[model samples]
Target: MRDPVLKHRARGMRMVPTDAERHLWQYLRNGQLGGWRFRRQHPIPPYILDFVCLEVCLAVEVDGGQHADSGYDEARTAFLKSRGWRVLRFWNNDVLRNPEGVAASVLEALGGVRRADTCPHPDPPPLGGGGN
Candidate 1:
């Protein structure tokens, strides 16, 4: 149920990313951050996430001054949350000037768990018929 138009737009966005996006991509690409794969300019239908880790259902957004107090962004965040995605937002300046801090926050939201070692479900049901 993917939207083709949004997918095309996302592809175009990836071709010419903003300065902050470009810089942040260096840290997020190729499982560089926490060994978790992140897709840049990823489409989630009706919106394009700046970056998303599908494994953890986490979305990261970097915003410029134009987004200050934006009603649209608020709505978008609400929608994404309703769909079970954890959203983290950072100012463009912060990403450019303090990437380490931003990355730390993202990692913290990710529960500081490395992707390969982390289990999707921490507790599993026992396999046998109990006390038969």
Candidate 2:
């Protein structure tokens, strides 16, 4: 179930994500990131994340000038990290200017945990009838 507060916040204001966000979304929207689906403006627990890859517990934030407030960003990052989520931030310009680099970095981070299943070994058998 989704958090009520998050749902309220989401409904309160439509966040017109920047150009960088749109660009990144193009790559991430359709399971383009190694077939991992990503959500935009996702609310995770108590916080609203810019983008989230639930499959890998990855969060991406595109920051504009307002994020210069070090204290706030630090606190947010700390909170997310504490929740077992890895957060990655990128300047809006960086993403707008070079989305490929951003994609590469995200892919690299995903590398460590890109197995078929994050669960421990002793893999389960294929669902339904195997070989087609």
Candidate 3:
């Protein structure tokens, strides 16, 4: 039962993640979202998430035309909620038009985890070279 439902959704999700999903995926795919690694098209309990950060119990869904089926989407969300996952949905247009805002929203939803700094630190001198 669960397998079929998941498989069905997986197929639909794969048809082509909307432009927004792709845009968001750029940040999420490489741990760019709040420095936490996120998986795209991840399979959770009874559903496949558009993006998920397992450590934070967060799932981001990029909704497209088919999402007009509110009834089914609601049921899916309810199931995910029951499993302790927080789901965030964004329309495809929203993402495409505001990728930065979308990324900010995702980061905000992640409780503001710190991102790594890019500057390199100077190496300490060898122990022998240091004065005792």
Candidate 4:
């Protein structure tokens, strides 16, 4: 179960996204990036992801100078990875100055592959294969 406080915090963050976050969101929202849907300010326990495609288990984070060389980020990434998520981090300047490039990198990581471990549903049985 998710903490209610964290869920509320994530909702509040969505209401006041930073410039870089807003910029990246344009590229990520509505399945604009290679048909992958991304949710901003999504709560995933212990942390709120800046953006996440839950279907593919991909997390995209945009950071400012304050996050440079931060140990907290390293541990956070490890935790997400342990939960079967693949995290991609970008600097605010990079996203603001070259939004296209940042988006391209994210698309490349998506690569049209959905990991079974991360997919929400198991593969369904083939039609007409299973006996009644």
Deviation (Å) of 100 in candidate 4? 0.6
> Against the true structure, what is each candidate's TM-score?
0.83, 0.78, 0.71, 0.86
Candidate with top TM-score is 4
lDDT of 2 by residue, 1-132 (tens): 346778678445336767888898888888898887888887665677778787767889999988987788899899877767789999999999999999889888888886443322112346775765
- Native-referenced Cα lDDT, model 1: 0.83
What ranges in model 2 sit over 4 Å off?
A: 11-15, 115-132
Output the better candidate (2/3) by TM-score: 2
lDDT of candidate 4 over 1-132, digit per residue (tens) = 437899899999999999999999999999999888899998887799999988888899999999989999999999888867889999999999999999999999989676455544212445676665
Candidate 2: worst-modelled 10 consecutive residues by lDDT: 116-125
Candidate with maximal lDDT: 4
Which residue pairs collide, candidate 1? Answer: none
In model 1, the worst 10-residue window by lDDT is 117-126
Candidate 1 total steric clashes: 0
lDDT of each: 0.83, 0.77, 0.74, 0.88
- Runs of candidate 4 with Cα error greater than 4 angstroms are 115-132
